[model samples]
Target: MPDGNRQIVLTSRPTGWVAPENFELREGTVPEPGSGDVLVRNIFMSLDPYMRGRMNEAKSYASSFEIGEVLQARVIGEVAASKNDGYAAGDIVFGMLGWEDYSLAKGAASLRHVDAELAPLPYYLGALGMPGMTAWIGLREIGQPKAGETLFVSAASGAVGQIAGQIGRIRGCRVVGSAGSDAKAAYVADELGFDAAFNYKTAESYLAALQERCPDGLDVYFDNVGGAMLDAALEVANPFARFVECGMISQYNLVEREGVQNLVYLTRKRIRMQGFIVSDHSDLLPEFMAEMAGWLESGEVKYRVDVADGLENAPATFIAMLKGENFGKQVVRIGPDS
Candidate 1:
């Protein structure tokens, strides 16, 4: 156990774009665990697009992060001290813990043991974790892409989109993707095996790019970077297409969100557009973990991570991720694995 604990707190709410000033790091006493409680030494902290919404004061699907309070994230940690019958010291676990060196969890409800031998600990924060499940549940319940259908994914090289497009391939769908850069687009097409991909930032137009990539028209749209891309997807969507609404990273920092003017396509084409949060489908975790892990082990699925070392760099890493600077699943390596 460390003599002291270090933590990051939300200093203020952002009007639009989040900045490093919004977060502040502080030193504190290491938390003491009572009965049925566990003290975790956070090793890998996840920086996700969804966390941006929680920074606001306004109410939404998730609770807001109170000012001056330690920011919470899905963290992979080592159990340093435990008073719970379900857990013991030296166990590796996952939980919604603070962005700090040490986090206190309340028994199994707040933590779940993970096998480090099964996959790297960081995989729990990416492929075998929330991002992977987000891809699975969204496709299973909404996209429902059929074999031979054309499926498109925006932010194709991102944490969730990369997984989603590969899952589409497994289902025998012709997958297309759009990324922020030519390199990312190529990575998705060449490395990740997408049928086709384009750099959305360099595209002549979202609709034009989508049309060229999805010549047959889209049957399923796994939306991550929404806004203009969403409107374009509507224009190219085939009748009875399914649109799975994931995070909208492009619009998350906008003062006024862009409106979808092509919504008429939803009714005219009989398209089903639905939004989902990965946490809402906790019951599907076991199923998602088993399937994704097998795919990863078999080389059917591949993943990438953009790691920033040190806890102090978490704020900068998070800001970079939102700006589309990170290559893949962004994680902050806070401590040594041992």
Candidate 2:
């Protein structure tokens, strides 16, 4: 067993964009599991866009990460010690742990055993986890896509967008996606079975691109990158279109968020634009997991992962992810699976 636990702490809050300097790595004594507590040695840690919002002191759906405290994230770990009856040493578990080598899970609510034989441990943090669940709930409940209808997803090659686009295809919708690069666009269209995709970076105009690709107009818009993309989507939306507002990565770092100019189209077209937090829809997780597991097993849905080695690299990896440098779902490998 390791003598100490390593953790990343938020040193300062970012004014605009997050920097590596905002974080500090510290080593401390490994925590021991008390009664009803389980000590887990983390193997993987998920880095997501939502964490950006948590950095700020302002209130949101989740609480802010306090400075000088260990950052929290969805982590997959192996039980190192256990005082809880439900868990034992050598058990693989998934939970909301911290950005550290070892975490002490207090109760059953904090951890759940994961089957390593079913899938790779990392998949529990990506496709079978929060990102996958986000895609499922947002598309099915909010987007409400129909067969032969047109669906457009912004940030199409991203964690949520990739799964959302595939789900749209399963529903028999013509799925169109917008990515940051030509390669990413191609991967979404060719590899992930998107009907059409465009590189938003090189496109002459978002409206023109959408017009060219989605000639029939969009019936559902699974929005991830907002700003001008959201405006363009609104302009090309059909009457009674459903806009599933997932995340706005484009405006996350900006001091002033960009306003949508084509919102007038929303009223004219009778569009329904609804934003959601994935945790609020946990009621659907059981159904989602059953369906998603089948799709994955049947090769109907595919996923990609962008892994960064070591907990020390998490700060830089997180910054790059915010800038769209990551190709897929970004996660950190803190320790070996064994």
Candidate 3:
């Protein structure tokens, strides 16, 4: 075991786009577990869009990250030491741990045991973790998709979007996706089984693209990139359509958010547009896990991971992810599982 822990801390908050200078990498002594706590050596750390909201000074569903404090993320790690009865040394676990070589779980509350045999360690951060849960809850609870309906997903090649689109397919819906690149669009349609996909960047207009692909109109719109896409979805939505607002990666870094001019369609079309936070539906986790685990085990669902090696690169990786530069679920491999 290393004598010191390497950590990434938020040195400053961002005004618009997050910069690498906003973060600082430092080394400190490995944290010791207190009573009822467990010490974990982080193997993988998840990079997500939600973390961007946390970096700001304003409060959201979760508290903002404090300046000079170590960043926090969903990490898959092995227990190095344990004072908690529920966890033992060598136990693989997943939790809201820090962006560091090691993390001290103050209590077992945020941590859950991970069966490494069920899936790879990194899958817990993507497919089997928060991203997957976000996809499941948004589609099942809010989207309320039905068979033969057309479903559209923005940022379709991404973590939550990929899973959300696949779930639409499993529900017997015709799933169309919009990605940033042609290759990403192809991956969404070809590899992930999306009915059709287009590159939003190359498309003349989102409205035109949606109209061409979803000729019958969209019954469910799983939105990850808000702004222009949301506007287009509004225009193309079928009457009584369900719009699940997951996140707005497009608007997250903008100094002034882009406004949707077509919201009038919501009233005219009787569309149900709702936003959700995954944490709010913890009760559905067991049901979600059962179904998701089965899909993962049976190979019904396919997931991709974009990994950045080393803790120091987390800030760069996170910045790239915010810009849609990452190809799939972005994660930082900070330490070896072994």
Candidate 4:
């Protein structure tokens, strides 16, 4: 272990698009745990779209990331030292920890032990963790896709979107997805078993693409990218369709957010559209775990991850993810897992 700890800190808040100058890589002394804390050697840290919202000064569902402070994310780590009675050294756990070589999980509530024997440590940050749960919650609580229905998932190759599209398939729905590139679209359609998928960036028109992929119209729309694609989804949505608004990455970094010109479709088609935060449904974790575990164990679900090698690369990886450049769930590996 190194005598010093390396961390990524937010230097300045981004006004529009996030730039590399917005962050700094700094080294500090490795910290010791306090009375109720455990010191963790962070192995993998998640990079998510929601973190973009947290960078802003404006108040939102989650607290804003203060400039000059180490940015935080869902991390998979092993306890290196412990001052808490319930924890011991070498325990693999998952926590909302910092983007550093080591972090302090201040209390039991701040993290929970994960079964590394059951799955890979990184899986706790992706498939079996927050992203997986987010996909489940949005589908179960909002979209509620039915058998024979046409389900459309935007950003289908992403962390949550991939799971959402797979779950829709398990529910007997005909799943179609939209991705940024032909390779990503093919990954969803050929590898992930989506009924069909299209590269939205290359398509002549979003509506035309959807028409070719989803001929029956969308009975459920799992929206991760909102903008013109959303307007196109509204145009192609069937009456009484359910729209699950998970995240809007397309508009997240924009100075002037785009307006939905086709919101009138919500009333005209009696479409039920709702946005949700997965944290609000924390009580459903056990239920979601059971359901997802079955799917994962049975080979009914597949997950992909794009891992950047070091903690110093986190900021660049995050910016790339925001630009739809990541192949799947974006993660940063800071330390050896074992």
Candidate 5:
């Protein structure tokens, strides 16, 4: 059995956007596993932009938070003790754990055992996990990017965005991406093989910047930062273009959501703009895992991570990620393997 536990809880709901004060740190003795449950020691806890939605007491694809409840997240852990038949001590798995030093795996259905030989454990939470699945489905299934098409992605250096651009490149598309800084832009363009990249923060105007990179026209837009980037993409979209709306980090902290003035351009371009949640594509997870694994093994796809050292920093990491401070996928290291 585990001897110690530390965790982060949502002490208060954020009125408009998340604040550091909303999180509270707590510690206690780790409880032992019971029948059908496995006591797991957390190694890596994932911090993502989606956690912001969970901070507000509002309805969305997932449930909102209640004050003082421990925030939910995905974590990779090793079984310290187990009463479950399928899992035993020292087995590594990833599941919907939370911001904690220890967690109980309730059952085997959602928890997936991982092979570290195949990839690093943290990769299970990033490239081989939800974010990777998101990029795959958004590009191939929703956007349907084809060979020679011009593709654009916002938040291009982020976990999902980086993967999305790589997927676009793999499809033989001419890909351009926008990031928050020059360094991030270079990471996408030079390291990630984006055809062109720009720092959206310094770009005079969104439309002008996108037009400069995609002069011919954008055939597919994998939108991560919604507001101006979406509006700009709409302006340069060719006839029959597709826009996969994955996330909207640009307006996430705004008290009032920014309205796009160029939405009318979508009509003229006959663009198909659609929003998607990853749960909607559960049927494709197995297929995506197979393909992404192949891509990883062959070095066709690569990823980066900005990891914080403790669970107590989860909130700060999440808030920073929304502000474009994190260079890659943000994750928190909670405890060491037993």
Candidate 6:
């Protein structure tokens, strides 16, 4: 037996910037399950920066989205019906379930049972999930921040950046962050324990601002926005500095990204720069979650969420996030799972 489902599909692709009109909400019949399948009712949905890359047909680390397909997102849902031996009807799981109220998943290994006892179901899509995992590995494996060293992060109040700064602080680094607004900057510095944070939008000279705050120079630069910020950090690098290229939100909208005028500084400073994605390092998830869970339980870590009330608002909320309108991790609450 198949149950009817409602879903939001990508009606059109964004040529430059995404608009809410680019998405369409449609009601459809729920798919039937095969022998090894489950029907799920989604409770929470995630909005992420990487989804912007998916909107384009350009080649990248991930595949581009096909027009008219359901917009993809990580979701937390309850299994309403199940035929898979590994799962049961009442199991609450988190996975890539797309933007929908319900879905039929057949042998979807990405879907895993979630422990609601660990945190709220929404957390699987935010702090305690992929974003958190990305921060842990980027800081530990790539950035390699050292105690008493200056660690700089852009988009510091976002899902990944927030955790990255916290992790750096835990490692005894002097962490500084750049955010879009004063409030966000204050939150990163005051609440997240970043040694210093600035509103990048208002700063006239990034290098000068960083120099004023991080007089010791940056040993680790966890980059979220590329372009001038990278160039600025390059000029302020300490000997053998490390740069973690996690994202380039600043260049995503531009047809031609700005160049780093200070490339010579990298050679002069002996800096090591690298890029990484969490999907490629899935092996680290088990250990990462255990550590993150312990941090949360011990009050060493804190997370913030910017949530929208319903699935219908998901498109606008996602668009707002891309424009830096969201204060923290952007999530959508779909109807309650039964």
lDDT of candidates 1 onward, in order = 0.93, 0.93, 0.93, 0.92, 0.87, 0.88
Q: Write the per-residue lDDT of candidate 5 for residues 148-254, one digit (tens) a residue.
A: 99999999999899999999999999999999899999999999999999998999998899999998899999999888788878888999999999999877778
**Candidate 3 on 1-338: residue-level lDDT in tens?**
67999989999999999999999999888977789999999999999999999999886889999999999999999999999999999999999999999999998769999889998888898888899999999998899999999999999999999999999999999999999999999999999999999999999988899999999999999999989899999999999999999998899999998888999998999999999999999998889888999999999999999999999899999999998899999999998888
In model 3, the Cα lDDT at residue 30 comes to: 91
What are the C-alpha RMSDs, in order, of all predicted structures?
0.9, 0.8, 0.9, 0.9, 1.2, 1.5
TM-score of 2: 0.99
TM-score per model over all chains: 0.98, 0.99, 0.98, 0.98, 0.97, 0.97
Compose the digit string of candidate 4's lDDT tens values, residues 224-336.
99899999999999999999999898999999999999999999999999999999999999998888878888899999988899888899899999999999888989989
> What global local distance difference test value does model 5 have?
0.87
**How many residue pairs clash (N, CA or C atoms closer than 3 angstroms) in each of the candidate models, in the order given?**
0, 0, 0, 0, 0, 1
- CA RMSD (A), model 1: 0.9
- Cα displacement (angstroms), candidate 2, residue 6, comes to 0.9
Pairs in clash, predicted candidate 1: none
Residues 1-338 of candidate 2 have per-residue lDDT tens digits of: 77889999999999899998999999977987779899999999999999999999999999999999999999999999999999999999999999999998987466988878877777888889999999999987899999999999988888899999999999999999999999999999999999999999999999999999999999999999889999999999999999999999999999998887998987899999999999998888789888988999899999989889999999999999999998988999999988
Candidate 4 contains a number of clashing pairs equal to 0
User: In model 4, where do residues sit more than 4 Å from their true spots?
Assistant: none
Candidate 2 global CA lDDT score = 0.93
Clashes of 2: 0
What's the CA error at residue 271 for candidate 2, in Å? 0.3
Candidate 3 global TM-score: 0.98
Which of the two candidates, 1 or 6, achieves a greater lDDT against the reference?
A: 1
lDDT of 1 by residue, 163-196 (tens): 9999999999999999999999999999999999
